[model samples]
Target: NEVFDNLAMFAGYGFNKSHSAAYGMVTYQTAYLKAHHPVHMMAALMTNDADRTERVVRLINETKGMGIEVRPPDVNASSLDFTVAEGAIRFGLGAVKGVGHSAIEGILQARKDGPFLNLYDFCERVDLQKVNKRVVETLVKCGAFDSLADGPLPAGDLEALGHWRGRVDAAVATAFSLGQKKQADRDAGQGSLFDVADGLEAGPVSYPEASPWSDQVLLDAEKQCLGFYVSGHPLDRYEEELGVYATHTTETLERAAEREAVKIGGVVAELKERRSKRNDSRNAFLTFEDRAGQCEVLVFGARYAEFEDLLKKGEPLLVQGSVRIEGDEEPRERKIICDKVQLLLDAREELVNKVTVQLEADSLDEATVCELRDIFKKHQGDCATYLRLRVTLAGQAHFKLPVEYSVRPTDDLLQAVERLFGRGSVSLG
Candidate 1:
């Protein structure tokens, strides 16, 4: 009660100056350390928050971007906590969720003189009671035993590890039962009734074929140990395609506040609809997250309707617009005022909202090209209007624009041509 009373009083009338001073010193220390030595900082950070999910993830992201490689937790190589070696951050086995630190330490210390080369070697040397099946399973899931066994596929290691853990469990149970029977049999001078199952001997146990898991599976495993993904970013898969339309990364956009006609990319996290208090009009408020951080954007009037369906959550987008600085308007609010919201990959092509099909200029039969034109003339599909033809292959031989044609280059048609005609023969121009 006394402690609570003191805390309440301090909370109500805290000394901001003194607190700020203390906080400033700590902040400076952190900044200085981070700028000078990042790997040690990351390893220590991982140790402190070995159970947290997001913090560790953020740290991992920050660390990797600094060129420090975070190797996955391994049975033979890893220490109990994260370690900094040669400017790289090694994943801590003990940091993995569900695996006990004591068990991890036991395994590490057992292999201190050397690494366990195979499954049988691991079982033979390791203390089964301390570093049991559960610990081994965590290692396997995190690709800890990649150095030892050759599983069927890259992913077969996990399956093999799971199977082996089950066997280890069964083996322990049988061994306990057998030991009890042996004691009784020795006293009675006869065999006991129990026939204990020792399960499969470690040497004969075959490793399952392990195929590599999809991106999501690998991420989940990373999440288990270091509190976040240490191997790859979730956005890495779409980054290349997304880059085509996105003119600026998060960092560049933040610095682009004063520039005109900025382009930014992100995954849409939220969207809100609103009506103006002054008049009957529609607008959208958007929140998006890129690799760096979150930004809020606003789309006013007709543009909102143009991009309504695209504002859905988890939809990745590239937005081209002006940065709305705070106080730029009366009683101003800070935001990005969007001129356009679109798929970065889809929007940045030379032409947009239109599909173009290009035929091999040299290979195309002149009759076929004319036939394509005649067919389009018969069916007037005004909805899809963009078309292009490239014909000059010889040096300085200029392109000859064909007759004005309107053709609906649907996705199906593009895919069909790409599949049938092969790579160079067709392109979504």
Candidate 2:
């Protein structure tokens, strides 16, 4: 009798009347808000995920899919939390890695006075002890200091701004030092007593000249600061080159059929390694990305062994894989089961048709011709080489001259050509 009563009790069960009604109302309200106020809902969602970086990246991508732009962290406009500005989402400074809560509070407190005029103003105003040089450097690298120098800089303040010739690092360092010295003087009660001119301002500080950082270096620094790419992807410049070798981009995986073979090209963004449970064979799962989006690639067994040497972070690669689907649903996910991989440098030789160097007739001389020949000889391969000359006469005349020898379309050769004739003068078709 007791066993029968226990089975009957399990057979009929229901929630409390009040609890069921409350849950149903809450569910309906949530659904209504998500359906009606998607932007506000996403803003709340992102704000709730402030402490989680990977979640932020995923949400940023989701925001992009919804046609909303997420601007980089800016000192002039950002707040303690993510805020909507000018029809875009502004990244919160608090989300920046290596930036402590104290530093963020200090920045916000300082900005309450007014917008920072320049790098000097920023350094002078903020509590450098909490927001020190390292934190400032990270902010600058992630483009938080960009708005300060956007407009025309004041006269005699170029060195203070450090924006002259892209010497931001040197500029920021000098500004911080000046601010530190000023603070020390104030603390020590060492105000200038001998000054005949009490209100005269100091002259322009001198800053060293430095070339701008290359795109790759800048992007790497951004990734370190923000935990993902914001301004641009590393593979952005190679989009044209990849079109010839890649059958699909990471963004196109949605329409791809499961088990269909496809070729993709991207820079390796992340990699994870594990040992199999059965035989302890090495395997890995990698995340690679192009300008379009990022996708995951699984490398196991012989494939892992074959490409282990090339599977490095930030390396450009072309991968052959089969599409995989998780479920038959409206928002189905697609991943790649990597079968083969090749370095982009190697793919260039097989994909390029010819290297064309465009030059003006006035610039063409015996030395120039000999130098071009030397460059071609250094990278000898099967890709044909050509010279396009623009001659100025009664009317503009163009001449297409073929080189006697073919050369490998290597990156070094392309860079050399660009250096000789300036950028956009070299092309590979």
Candidate 3:
């Protein structure tokens, strides 16, 4: 308590020149090491955060991004903390959610005599009580046991792969019984002490596939290691369509808002509702994005009334309006708000951000609207804007104003428009 009181000391003052110089030197050294040897740097990061599971996962991704191949945590090779060997980083057993240091240490100690040849060999050597099926399964899912397993099980065979997990415990129990029998043999002096080496069971089974999964699928599996999706984002599937309506990627959107009007698109990541200071009914926030990136949408009750339909998460919308730099009155510079969403389509977002449908000047007939419906249906993001084109058929001048009006701004709508109209006709604005 006395030491704690002295250490508190109401925080501190600025650093001296020597302190600054030393700090600068360390910072420069770290930066240089990171720039030149990112894998090693990330391995060190993983080790430092051994007790912090979440950060350890992040560092693992960072290592992979640097092209450092991570050796899965193996019964034969891993330690409690992440280690680097021969320019490769090993997964840290301590990074797994349930397996703590003591449990990991127990497994590592078992490996000291020799490497685990297979699931059976590991079962014979390691203590199951310290490390259970749940712990082992987590390692397998994260690809930590991949080296020992040889290769991953077949695609979609993940659940069936549970068989190998049970093998470890069964093999260990069998090895214990053999050791007891050997003890009896030794006491009788009837057996040769130095004999032929024993063999291990086959590695975890491999499955048939023409090729490994696509990068997108592999990256998704990697996300199970890290809490958040790291490699390619979910929006990567429809980059062309998302870019049509989205003003900018979330990361880029944070930087500027010069344009008076902009269209930004994103998958609806999340939505939340809140009450204003005055307890007014309408206050909400939304986070979504396209492959380029993502952005947030904020709406107050008054604003929400008009844009309520667009506020939903995962909705592909080309929102047009002003970008106001909020909190600019004070010292802090903040985001520009996207005000008034004109069109939020229910369907997939396409390359065309907006749709312009042409109608004959004189025809309000059902046939004309029916034709418009058929044409608009082809669009992705289901977005459409109707425009009447008046031209002479030589007999009658036909004109039609929209009696009922709507469009689904979807990704297909954009692509369909590109096919029907010229590429430039369906612009985001």
Candidate 4:
């Protein structure tokens, strides 16, 4: 009995020592690889966790923090797994939702002859039976064919065929129709006169004109197909406002003091509502994402009721909350208890007091000043305007405009000013 008890104890405790040693060695090796080969390691890590969208997003952010760029999926460039391209990590086609292994294989086999020249060329060459319309549309929506769309075209062709998602989508349908006809003829052993005549060719390709998608629309499409934003985040436009108004970022909230009051700004990445177990009160949890990272915000009882309308996915919100850290663990569970919330745009309008336009002395011609005056008049409001003129050797001069010249510093006005003066010319205070 004593011997059996001793053996059982050893089996339970002594075996753990060997297991711990093995784990320790593996941990050390992984840490070493991450420290030295961060890009390669992160690429592998991302590929391994590609099925987990949330984990992939976290890894992508970590890769960026390590000074490694994670490029979007490209049908012409990416393989089935994440690949290293010019010191950056290229996302894999296999990671994209709705693109199956067979579809990727078909795309790869078709591209072996050469890189796809355009959407038409891509559709014509690839086996449409495998790389179907839905697969092609999903790839295009997620920016897999962005390189092809953005590539230089023959002289006047680009202006006539203006490359936008809507145009690309229309072109895809036309290309598929032509491809199907050609395939049908070939299968039937019938040849057209143009096929027999080497000198003859098809006419120029034309795309239907469409208004370009807004940044929000593009991001939404990316999220739909890729499970996350690859090209850009929706909150990117509110960067300046977030910087000025937000007291904490999702990343910085980890170190927030217990029950500390804070203001955070981000788009609602996710929202889940439920009834509280104790009181049967409606409560909700929001996964908020900014440029830095993501955090959870808990809205309970009256707070959920007050902010229910604002807790919508993809909507930018400036949240006033207090941190709630549970336990004293190394990586404790942290969440924000929502106190109040408001639209990010509304917060920006209420907070921004001044707008400054920086101009080079040589660029300040009569035409430029007249355009600036017209812009101010077009957006007339209460925000003060100032012009900083940069002169060679004499230093810059700041001139505040009269109260009548003050204008509303809305996104449209800012965009107009940027379009006229170029980026980095305008600042808000």
Candidate 5:
């Protein structure tokens, strides 16, 4: 009777030899292709599931792991499907949230005629009905129009990019109006009756220079549109502070032995609230992402309540936890059971002892000195501030001078000092 029961169970679960062989062969082929032709394979994978934002984000991380870059969507270069370009995968326009198939077709058709010279040219050519203001905003946020910009942007200048983007966006309506008027005049084969003998030149449309958005603002915009940071992780700004506190990065956490105690810092990328099965108390799961990658953190019961306010999306967090590796998984295979949580800014404040600024002796004018004093006055705090004045003459050494009053060593204060003196001029000890 026991043998009969075992036979029935095997019959219910087993597959034929031919079927097993077919499945194995297909898996082998896929693994072989992925190993040898990662770019092509990833492009196909991305193209196939372009509509699923979460899946696209995961695949994008996978592509990065394979050392393949995923370029932002380009109005001039992108297609309906993800395409291999310059050894990288360019994001498909169809995948962009507000962009639709009609817009993709129109953009492709317009590009076929000639590459768009600028935002004005794009507005003139593409079908506005399909590609509206909302679509343009989304494209700008995701860097689709980057190639069409006036020149190459400085790396690590997302704020500058944001400022420039705001100006360009503010000018879009006027540019579109001018472009449309020109097209209308051409179609009618008649210049405006008041037009000058020399074909009317719409003098270059100019935009008022605007202040740059903060780094967090830029990253938030990226998060809104692309479901992840494409240019750089938000935690990148706090790398130095994180290095001081974190024992392991997300990548290192994965390679660590299970149950190893670790401290990690990252911006909260995702959060889900749940009720515990046993006690019905509120618990939370968070996806924390640093420059290296992301890891999952579990906050249960009392711990969840303690850190609930700090669990905001886009906020940076420092977590003390232990590694929790489950049965093998392909993507995002590591987890953390958080023991303690603190805001990353709070951690920085506790770790940093002093702030230092560097200046050239010759450049320290009376006006500059007043501005420096005002900056210090603006941020009165407990952390001591020091200045290093560089003397250019040979045999004259730089000297350090400590200010009598200490100032608060907040991120805002650091940013303000950096902005006035330029980055790399300010340091925290």
Candidate 6:
């Protein structure tokens, strides 16, 4: 019995040592690949986890952090798997929502002759039966057809249709009509105008006038179709404001102290309302996303009732809460227990009391002064304005504008000021 026990102990130690050695070798290999071939390694990782949206989002962010760009899916460039293109990663079509393997195969086969010329050409060439209108719409929304926008339009074909995406969307029906006719003609073994010996061809594709979608609308469409933002985030325009007001971001929250009071700003990515069985009190869980990533914010009982109206999805919000940490595991579960919530725009207006613009002495000419006055007049409000002039290399002067020159510190007003003077010229207090 003693000998058997001794043998068992030795066997356990030997197994543990061998396991550690194997794990250490794998770690070394992974680190070497990450350092030497970051782009390829990241592309492989993203492609491996393409079906998992959350994992893909995290990996894409990490890829960006490594100074590698991950371009959106392009019908002209992307393949079934993520590929390295010009030292960057091109998103895969297979990962795109609403696009099946068959659709990808059809697109790949159709584009084998050459690149797709335009939306009309793409619709006419591909098998519309397999790559249906919904798939095309999803691709358009996710920016796969953005490259085709650079193609030249026919002469004298001018319209007020907003952006290239807007024009393409408006012309989808007409393009589909033409594509269907061509397909029917081919199936019937009938020659179309293009097949004629003469240089006869179809008329130019025309797009109707339509207003462009807002940035938020475009971003929402991307999120709906690709499960993440490709071109830009909805909160991108509010970056400066968030930097000034937010005390904690999703990335920073990982290291935050338990029960630490914190203020965070983000767009509400998702929301779920629930009722307690014991008292039937209402509560809610919100998936809040900032520039870095996403986190959960919990609003319970009284807090939920106090801010129920403001807890809307896709709206930017400023949340004040305490970090609640549970478990002593390697990755502890963390969530924010909401104490207060308000619209980010409203918070900016209420918190900022002063706006200061810095200018060089030489640039503050009569015309510049007039433009500044016009900007102030356009956004009249209660926030006080001050001008700081750099008179010389080591000398400066500060002047407080009269109450009449004061203006609201809204985004438009700030943007106008920055545009006139330059970025980093306007600071809000």
Q: TM-score: which candidate is best?
A: 4
Measured on C-alpha atoms, candidate 4 has an lDDT of: 0.82
Clashes of 3: 43
Error of 3 at 46 (Å): 3.6
Error of 2 at 179 (Å): 2.7
What TM-scores do the predictions have?
0.48, 0.75, 0.50, 0.89, 0.80, 0.82
Roughly what TM-score does model 3 have, to 2 decimal places? 0.50
Candidate 5: residue 131 lDDT (0-100): 66
The candidate that achieves the highest lDDT relative to the unseen native structure: 6
What are the per-residue Cα lDDT tens digits for candidate 2 across 231-311?
667665456788777889988877899899999998887889999999999999888877677888999988999899898
Of the two candidates 4 and 5, the one with more favorable TM-score, higher being better, is 4
Question: What is the Cα-based TM-score of model 6?
Answer: 0.82
lDDT digits (tens) for residues 354-414 of candidate 1: 3344555565686765765565465343334333455566432224223344444433343
Sort by TM-score, top down from the best: 4, 6, 5, 2, 3, 1
- Provide backbone clash counts, one per model: 10, 0, 43, 0, 2, 0
Candidate ranking under lDDT, highest first, comes to: 6, 4, 5, 2, 1, 3
Q: Tens digit of lDDT per residue, candidate 6, span 1-429? A: 999999999998888999999999999999999999999999999899988887888999889988899988999999999999899999999889889999999999999968887788888889998888888888888888877765643321111112566767777788888888878887899966655532134344556655665556677888887778876675665677778888999999998989999999888878899999999999999988888989999999999998988886467789999999978896787799999998887888888888899999988889999999999999999999999999999999999999998888877887688778876789877
Runs off by more than 4 Å, candidate 5: 1-37, 65-67, 172-203, 208-211, 256-260, 277-280, 323-325, 328-334, 358-373, 387-400, 403-405
Error of 1 at 227 (Å): 4.3
Question: Which residue pairs collide in model 2, if any?
Answer: none
TM for candidate 2 is: 0.75
Write one digit per residue (lDDT tens) for candidate 5, span 192-218.
555543224433445656666667776
Off by over 4 Å in 2: 1-41, 150-166, 171-173, 191-206, 326-332, 356-382, 385-400, 404-427
**In candidate 3, how many Å is residue 337 off?**
4.7
Model 5 clash pairs? 381-407, 381-408
lDDT of each: 0.61, 0.77, 0.55, 0.82, 0.78, 0.83
